[model samples]
Target: MAVALITGSAGLIGSEAVDSLVARGFDVVGIDNDMRRRFFGDDASTSWQKSELERRHGRRYVHEAIDIRDADALMTLFDRYGDSIRVIIHTAAQPSHDWAAREPFTDFSVNATGTLNMLEACRTHCPDAVFVFTSTNKVYGDTPNRLPLIEQDTRWEIDPGHPFAEGIDESMSIDQSTHSLFGASKVAADVLVQEYGRYFGMRTGVFRGGCLTGPHHSGTMLHGFLAYLMKCTVTGTPYRVFGYKGKQVRDNIHSADLVSAFHAFIDAPHAGEVYNMGGSRFSHCSMLEAIALCQEIAGRPLSWSYEEQNRVGDHIWYVSDIGKFRRHYPAWVQQYDLTALLRDIHDQNVERWHAGATR
Candidate 1:
């Protein structure tokens, strides 16, 4: 039987990948050490998701509490699976922009070095496995912020005549920008993934994703935008809108949709290819727009405050141009739009809060 190893298996993307792959008949092995709890606290812990997966999938989904930074541990797993491992979906990382500045070492080690370890394991033990990496749009850093943006009532938008008006693409320069510590580390890992595929001929693909969110996300203040927003709405917690008049925009792709893209790449494995993945024009919103949606879902006014200071190296407007991926995999299409996606998150979060499973 074929085996697939997924790092960050309890994460929003990783967990979704596990369920999708397992249902498709692969014996899935997952690696997660609940580092999210360490990164964002108990409220953002994925322990519940991990338990749920094990309870539901049982023997079909093997769970490992291993850190990707531990090369020996990763190598052991790689050797154990050997040639049977047909896919490696790496989603584990210290995913935070502001948090990265606090501990650059931990962020870099986890994001950059951890990716290297995974690549080496694939090369050494399972060279033929399809390696799919979850990179971030932050890789373009503040470069996107340089675009001509107009302030709408609820969101910032690119000039209609601009090349990137539709959305930013992979062609955007990752150079000469203020990439936060997190973005820099991801850039290092992203480039390395490409080099491994191009230089060594490994089947690897890098997806530069926008706001990836869903019900399974352990949404925290530092990351998981849409999910975290829903969490705040469900609990009536005060939500902070940082800078750009809360009009900074982001395209959110459902976790399941992103994982489907991963499966597409795996089915037709490519080398060193990069795709900007997100909702694009089909779905996106600013903080203000999202707050309105959250309020509608909760049937109450959301408690939110504004901060004049924006996040460092944050984009003013970013919707991914998924044209390349769509062109490559013609069968791939978005399963959920923004309204349906937010509703799913709102309903799930409400259920979790009622069950006393969330903060």
Candidate 2:
């Protein structure tokens, strides 16, 4: 049996990936320390993920409460799995862009140094394994803003006359803007994952994704935009839009789509290859667009307020050019577009919150 090891297995992306892997017949092991709750002082939704996995898939899911920073613990997990491990999906990291400012070093330790530990552990214990990393569009920084933008009634966008109404491709420069602390740390991790592939001949691939969202998300007011918006709409909490007239655009890919990409990458492994993974032009939407989606999905208008101040490093418009990935994996297509995706989240949050409401 093919063994797949996933770090950050309790996270939105990781947990969804686990379900995807098991359905495809991979014996999966998940590891997480739930540090997100510890760091943010908010409820972590991972407990449901674990319980759901067991309930749905029986005993197929194995879990470890292991922090990636602890090299010994990581190695011990690797050692136990040993030769059975065919793929190592590194989804663990300090994922928040806002918190990186408050705690840059801790971000570095987890996003950069912690990634190095995973690579080193793989090198030591699972040399022949395929390593897949989840990187961010933030690595491209705000340089895209320098490109001429056209203001529409609802949002700002790259000039339609430019080569890509399709969206920004991988060749777009990442060096011009001052990447925020979170971007820098992720860039460090991104480069090293490539280096491991280039220098050590490990089969490694990096996916610099835009907004990755799903129902399993641990939504917060500051991040996980779609999830937070859904939560507020469902629970009657207030929601805020930070800047750019609440029309800043982003392309969102569901966690299930990302898992499909992983399966595609593993089937046709690429070494040191990086691609932009997200909803393309077809899946892109603005904050106002998203709020409208939420309103439509919930059958009521959202209780949201607007704020004019922009967050540091926030982009006015961000969308991925998925042509490269499409060309490579023609069979792999997005299962959910923006409307359908938001509806799923809205429905899930409604059910989850209602269940709690009854309790």
Candidate 3:
């Protein structure tokens, strides 16, 4: 049986990948230990999503509560699947910068060494399987903050004449900037993915993504920006804005849209291909703008306060240039913009938020 193996299988991206791969008729094996609960608290746990995936897909979806950091366990899993596994999507990571500082070893072991284990397994067993990594734009670190920006009422805008005004492309350097502890670990993993393809000749692709959000995201204040903001709006939970006078900008992409891009790459696998993937200019907003949109869409006011001290290594402005990915996969289209995206999140999870509140 053709199989699709996904790490972080219960996360926003991994769960979405599970649904997509399973629908396309692949037996899916998922690896997750719900470490998010450790990183952020019970509120950010993905256990519910794990159960939902099993309930929805039944025998087709197999959930393994395996930690990717466990090399021997991963090796065994890969050997069992062998050449039958057609694709490996690695979306699992300690996703927050603040959390990384608290536990550097845990972050590095999972993000860097964990990736190595996956690559080694792919090399030893399913050498032909396409490996896709969900890398973060934070790899560029605070470098994006160096852009020429104008402070608007609710947002920071790049000069229209600026080369990157359209969006930041793959040309931007990932070095010589202050990457947070989390970003540093991801960089190690990102480079390793590229090296595996370039050196070992594996079919691997790296996607340097912006804010990847969706209705399924177990959003926490520490990560999952748009999703968490919407949750606070819907539930009347207090939210806090950090840094840049709440005008720091970011781009958002829905999980389904990103998974579609993965399909395009998997259908036509490439070696060591890296793309800057996100909503780009089409779906970007500053913190204030996002708060406003969340409140409007959720039909509730968000209780929020701004902190003068911004999070260390946070970007003041970032919008991805997806031209490269589009140029490669012309048929792939981005379906969600900010309003449509927030609306989708609100529509899908309003009841869940309300339920959590009543309980």
Top candidate on lDDT is 3
The lDDT values for all models are: 0.93, 0.85, 0.93
Look at candidate 3 and give me any clashing residue pairs: none
lDDT of 2 by residue, 1-359 (tens): 68999988888889898898898899899888778776655555466676777677777888888888888988888888887889989998887778899999899999998999999989998889999999999998888777788889988888888886678899987786877899999999999999999999999999999999988887777668888787777777789889889989999998888889998999898888899998877678999988888877887778889889988777888889988888888998789899888877877678777565310
Worst window of 10 by summed lDDT in candidate 2: 350-359
* Model 2 stretches astray by more than 4 angstroms: 357-359
Candidate 1 residue lDDT tens string, 134-176:
9999999999988999988889999999988888999999999
Candidate 1 residues lying further than 4 Å off, grouped into runs, are none
Off by over 4 Å in 3: 357-359
Q: RMSD of each candidate?
A: 0.8, 1.7, 1.1
Error of 1 at 312 (Å): 0.5
Which candidate do you rate higher for TM-score, 1 or 2? 1
Return the TM-score for each candidate structure: 0.99, 0.96, 0.99
Which residue pairs in candidate 1 collide? none
Candidate number that wins on TM-score, 2 or 3: 3
Q: What is the Cα-based lDDT of residue 63 in candidate 3? A: 95
Pairs of colliding residues, candidate 2: none
- Model 2 collision count: 0
Taking all chains together, the TM-score of candidate 1 against the true structure is 0.99
- What clash count does candidate 3 reach? 0
